[model samples]
Target: MDTCYGTPNRKIVLLTCNVDDMTGEEIGFAREIMMKSGAMEFYTIPVQMKKSRPGFEIRVVSKPGDADNMAALLLKHTSTFGVRMQELSAYALERRSQVIHTPFGDVRRVIGEGYGVLKEKLENDDVCAYAEKAGVDRKTAERQIYALLEAEKQER
Candidate 1:
């Protein structure tokens, strides 16, 4: 998974590939691989090629500090031998917090309150533990957390 790193937390790296015309299925597979490699963004915008033929712009986004990780993934998944990379400075939500209440404990996830929106933040592990201890369905717990987050959004 993509971890947050870099000073000021501008950790988004984009890798672009300009390969020969590729099929939609191939593009989809490439996207899947990119996401699995922890790419935050995987897109293929359509573009006109030579003779007006159709082509795509394959791009993968990762943490700026993860430049090496993104490049390795690009080299492994795409047909291109090299991927162009660029570093960008952006202001993202400072960060979100997850409270890991060990078995049978209550977790009060304090979503970033200063950000544009405020809500409860429950990660997959949180839901799993809640379900395992509370005897609730994992999906149900996920929905519950989503509901809480949504309610908090409305309050903000």
Candidate 2:
């Protein structure tokens, strides 16, 4: 486990493998299996392998405790015979969720505090749902939510 100084921290394991023989459908299946097996994040990068063959390098991020399970899943679901593992530490800012009433509806905003400053972002799903419910475009809904948040900020 890796530790951070004076901040909330998490230890994660990164697993990477190069695969040259799996179809797109098979890759999607492997991604689902990895997610179900405790992979926090899974993605692939296109690369050219030996003999000029197009392939992908699959990368999986998992909690330290789930490393073994993730590795096993990768081995079973993908065509990779070997995996590279690395331990990593991450530090996150303090954050909290606040529900605000907007013209569209109630929306949740994530407020993060770091470096003596506050940063905020409106939840994407909430904004999308509000757009659907109000029959407005997504950009319009996003602007409305931002305007609401700005008003609240001024009030504070």
Candidate 3:
């Protein structure tokens, strides 16, 4: 089987640390901060720590050059004493966005193409807003937009 993505084009670092002390709101704030500070991706996974305590591991993907900065941010924002870093190779799709004009309005869609695979996804928020203004449900709006895209594709 052929893969949908091409070979890794970027070298990134994964920074992680386990913290059992912060509240949910605090973690959310830290996540926001990380995103704003140039973290490519930030997430948390629940885990059990020592003494049978529940904790979450903060995982951040960042550019290799920013690994130290990201780790410092994690240390300053979280209760963890230290952050771990691992370099990784990433394979990603090349993506672009287009606005399709329809009866409802202009709807934005993200197109990703790589290794002969093409995929498109409509923005949910745009669909929802248009649906409300057009007095239709989300599903109806989405269906109409997709149908229009399909017809355009067929014409081309």
Top candidate on lDDT is 3
Q: What is the lDDT of residue 41 in candidate 2?
A: 97
- Against the reference, the lDDT scores of all candidates come to 0.70, 0.89, 0.92
lDDT of 1 by residue, 1-156 (tens): 545444343556677876565667877887887788778888887777668777766888788767788788767767676789987765566567665434455555646543344445666666787778878999877776666657767989
Scored by lDDT, model 3 comes in at 0.92
TM-score per prediction, in order, is 0.56, 0.80, 0.87
Candidate 2 residue pairs in backbone clash: none
Give the Cα error of residue 66 in candidate 2, in Å. Answer: 1.2
Evaluation by lDDT, superior candidate among 1 and 3 = 3
Residue pairs that clash (backbone atoms under 3 angstroms), model 1: 11-63, 11-64, 12-64, 13-62
Give one digit per residue, the lDDT tens place, for model 3 in 1-156: 666455787799999999999999999999999999999999999999999999999999999999888999999999999999999997777899999998767899999888777889999999998898789999999998898989999999
**For this target, which candidate reaches the highest TM-score against the unseen true structure?**
3
Worst 10 residues of 3 by lDDT: 1-10
Ranking by TM-score: 3, 2, 1
Error of 1 at 26 (Å): 1.6
Q: Which model, 1 or 2, shows the larger TM-score?
A: 2
